[model samples]
Target: MKFYKKITEKSKSNSLVVLVSEDTDSINFSNDSVNLLFSESLSNEDLSSLGKITVLHTPDSLYKNFNFLRIICIGVGSLEEIDSNKIRRAAGSFGRYFLDSKLSNLSFFVDSIKSKDTDLITESFFEGFFLGNYIFDKYKSKKSEKKDVFFEVVSSEISNIQDIVNKSYEKSEAEKFARDLVNEPANVLTPTELSNIANNKTDKSISCKILSKEECAKLGMNAFLGVSQGSIEEPKLIHLSYKPLKNENSYWYIGKAITFDSGGLSLKPSGSMFSMKGDMGGSAAVIAAINAIANLKLKVNIDVLCLATENMPSGSAQRPSDVVRAMNGTYIEVENTDAEGRLTLADAITYAKGFDPKFIIDIATLTGAASIGLGKGNISAFSNNKDFMDKVKLAGDITGDFVWQLPLDSTSKKQNNSTVADIKNTGGRLAGTITAAHFINHFVEEVPWVHLDIAANSMTSSNDGWHNRGATGIPTRLLIELAYIFEK
Candidate 1:
């Protein structure tokens, strides 16, 4: 899509989108041609619903005068209640309308919105519109044809709109890249393939390294290796580092890169295993965030670690009673092979501590209980440091990738107690998310850390505002925003 910042009178597109406040009872349009069509529709339709889209087809004679085939008016709630996130959702609905109608050229008029900062409003709108246009049809034998959309943002005040547009475009593109990775089938996007993709990133400031199984074994990462033994494909431990010219305190982001999880020897039902391809959603988010951070030239030292492996069931798979030692010299007893995400993360977080990071954050599609607790919209977060976790929550609020904090008290810690080993992989059925985070906390030790259980937010069955039906790329933007905050 080609995005432009220009006056509404100068738009030469076939469609024009105007933002209307839900509190406003009457319709207002700057374009005479649009006013004539919209006024007619206003008399016949009720647009009191927020984010509701109403389309008005222009008369044959007026099309040439207005240079538009139709006018779409989207409601933006009360002006007092309007925020960047609301604007994003409204714009997303507008974008979806355009896609459904197969409209190629469109212009957005935000001149009606005068209460908010023009730059912020325009950027939010563009972010939502661009994200809403995302579609994953790679495997479709008969793909639907989509035209190159010509998008224009019309505003009287144009300062910083272009810069905002550029930045939002870059960030959203990075998010789309992550979504693509998550949407790929397990057959295509194996652990080795994921590592190769990370290695192929040609950013000069970013360096990529892939550790083979032999290297992992040499480093004593048996816990991570244990999860990989079942799969025929070799596991890859991916490390991507970004060093800025002026470095400050460094941080580590670890992602559980289970490319395809079949629950190992424990095994999952066929129904539950359908979307196991997205087991690496956390890894996708980290990789995408690193790509965006490098592209944006954020002057912060950061390291991304992905424990890439597939948890499959086979003759050589780790048994239920197996005990594996982690890189940090902690023994973990495997009570359930299905709780494999934490096993990989335990060793990865242990390795992350070697960097002596100021803070460590690990994201994983770790538990179904997390989804059961918080539903699919919010990420379940547990952090050892309150201040750092608050910063992360703030970042989530800013990015509209919400995170709800779950307790990690001493009571939850008792759930992981193991008689034979230091801790058990699974902490039974109760407080699954909390116990999982508690298990990882053992590896983090003194270094402040946050664990995000993204199982619910990774993929969605329904469209939610900026997110489409498939891979939502939940916390990629949150991580990028947090990186900027930490850098400051």
Candidate 2:
């Protein structure tokens, strides 16, 4: 989709558009652009009413009646209430409607945002709109129609912010790549295949390297390799590094790349294994963010590390009462193989520690407790650094990729105490997410680090935001946006 800025004026071509909160009865447009409004009369008298538009409100399906090529609308609400998130959702609604109706080309009126600056609403909307067009249908036989969209803003101020928007879109594309990898069936995206994808799709400007199981074993990545021993596919320690033009600062990103987690010999019930394809979401996200940053040529040094493996039930699979050593020379007791994400991540984080980065952020679908704690729309974060976590919170506020901080204090750490190894892989049954963070903290080596447990937000069970059906690509924008602040 192409995005542009055009002076607010009447159009000469036919288009279909949605007027979010316009009063259609009082529309006074002098141009050919048909405005469909979701009036106070049409909207529900509640909070949920914000993004709701009904067929009865517009009288005509704007797509059906508008011979003109685009439909435009203004989202009417108080500035305090009409936030960036609302703008993003409105954009998603616009894009989904356009694609469902099979409208080939359309543009929106960003000037119509009543309270916020046109640039903010316009950028937020496009981010959501473009994301809505995202799909992971690589293996599907039937596919949805593609959409080409353009956002026309009325101010030159937009040009200054256009780079940010483009970067956001680029980040989303990288995230989509990750989402596709996560959504792919386990049959195709094994540990070895995932390493190949990472090697091939890596930015040319960056350096890529992979450590095979033999190499990892030599370096004592037994914790990560133990989980992979069950699979016929080879396990890989995936590493990619991006060195900017000027070496000013460096951050390490670590991800858990479990290809197909069947809980190893401990085993998950049949129903619980349904979405295990998304087990590698964290690794995908880390690589995606790195790719975007490198592509945008951000002048910040970075390391992308992934511990890729599969946890399956087989003769050789690691089992309960097993002890394995990590790359950092720490031993782990495999109390429950179901808690395998952290094991892979431990080795990756331990490996990244050798680079002596200023900070490290490790992401993974590490715990179901994360979903239970933060739900499906929010990320569960645990960090020892307050300043870094504050930046993340602010970034989430701006990008609408919400993340809530969880505790990782002594109480949380105590839950992970192990009699046999340095720490237990599973943190007792309660506050599971926080304990998981505590477990990862054991390997971060006191660097200004944060753990993002993306079990809930990485992919959605339904369509919301700009995501269509499968992967939400949550926080990809937030991570990239936060990097800009750190780099500055």
Candidate 3:
């Protein structure tokens, strides 16, 4: 999707989108018949009911006078309730409209809405439209033969919307990149393949290094390696660094990139194992967020790291009751082989802490309890530092990626205590999300850290809001917004 915010007279898209609020009365057009239709339509029915869309097709005779072939009016609630998210979801439906209607392009025009916050409305429109125009038909024999889509936010009310559109495009495209990676089949997106993708995408501002199994073993990443021991495919510890010319602060982002989670010896049922390909959603988000940060040229230093592996059931696989040593010298007793993401994260976080980052934030699809607790669209966050978490929460809210903070009580930590090792992988059925977080926290040492349990929101089953079904690309925009917080 090409987002050209300002459309010139010579470059007019065939389809036009008009936003309707309670305050909207008449939709003005140079054509008298077009104005007449809208005026009569408004008198007969209210077009401002939130989420109500009224589409009108041009007749054959009016084709000469009709500047646009089709006009779609999207009602965006009352002016008081108007926000970015509503605009985002509504604008996002354009993708479906484009595919179904076979429309080449769309020009967005909002009425008196310009008197309010035009810039934010502009940003939300582009972000939503950009993000929503996604389709994962990689495996389909007959893929969508979609040409370049032209999206122009034709706002006479604002002059600076073009830059916002460009920025939102880059951000949304980064998320789309991650979504494409997460949606890939496990056979195609192995640990080695994911590492190569990371290495190939590194720009001049960023440097990427892939650590092999032998190197990881030398670094004492046995806990991470132990998870991949079941599979013939090799594991990788990918470290990507983005340092500004004038570095201000240091930050670390670690992700659990389980290319496929077969539950090791404690295998998952067939029904539950199908979507396990998305186990690497966290790592995809990390890579995507860092790419956006670099593309935006954010002046901050960040370490984007991933522990990529696959947890399969085999004779050599790490069995239940297996004790693995972390890079930080912490011992973990794996009572359930299904709880493998934290083992990789345990070793990865331990390795990241050695860099003495200002704060470490690790994201993973660590537990099913997260889905049970938060349902499908919210991210369950646990953090040791309140102030950093507060900033993270604000970022999530700003980007329309909802975040809820869960308590990190010392009481929950007790559930992870083990008889043989320092801690156990699973903390029983109760407080399962918190226990998984607590297990990852055990490796954080004294460094301030936040753990984002993205299990629930990682891969959405449907195309809702700005995301289209698989791989909601959780926290990609949130991470980009986080860089803004520090930039300020």
lDDT of each: 0.84, 0.73, 0.84
Q: What value does the lDDT take at residue 232 in candidate 1?
A: 98
lDDT of 2 by residue, 1-488 (tens): 34444434444333424344432233333333233232343354322245553332222354344334333443434555666688778667655666677455554434344454655565676677777666665666887655454443333335655565676578667767777777889999888888888898875788899998899998888888888988888898888988874655578878778888899999999998989988888888877888888888887788888888889989988989899888887888889999988888788777777777788888888888887877877789989899988988887887887888987778778878899888889877899998888888888867899888888887677787677788666667777777777778
Which of the two, 1 or 2, has more TM-score?
1
Q: Candidate 1 at residue 105, lDDT?
A: 82
lDDT of 3 by residue, 195-277 (tens): 99999998988999999999999998888888999999999889999989454557998888999998999999999999999
Q: All candidates' TM-scores?
A: 0.93, 0.87, 0.94
Which candidate's lDDT is highest?
A: 1
RMSD of candidates 1 onward, in order:
2.3, 4.2, 2.1
Candidate 1: regions farther than 4 A off: 1-9, 23-33, 36-44, 63-65, 116-120
Error of 2 at 247 (Å): 3.8
Q: Could you arrange the candidates by TM-score from highest to lowest?
A: 3, 1, 2
lDDT accuracy of residue 167 in candidate 1: 72
Q: Considering lDDT, which of the candidate structures 2 and 3 is the better prediction for this target?
A: 3
Q: Give the C-alpha lDDT of model 3.
A: 0.84
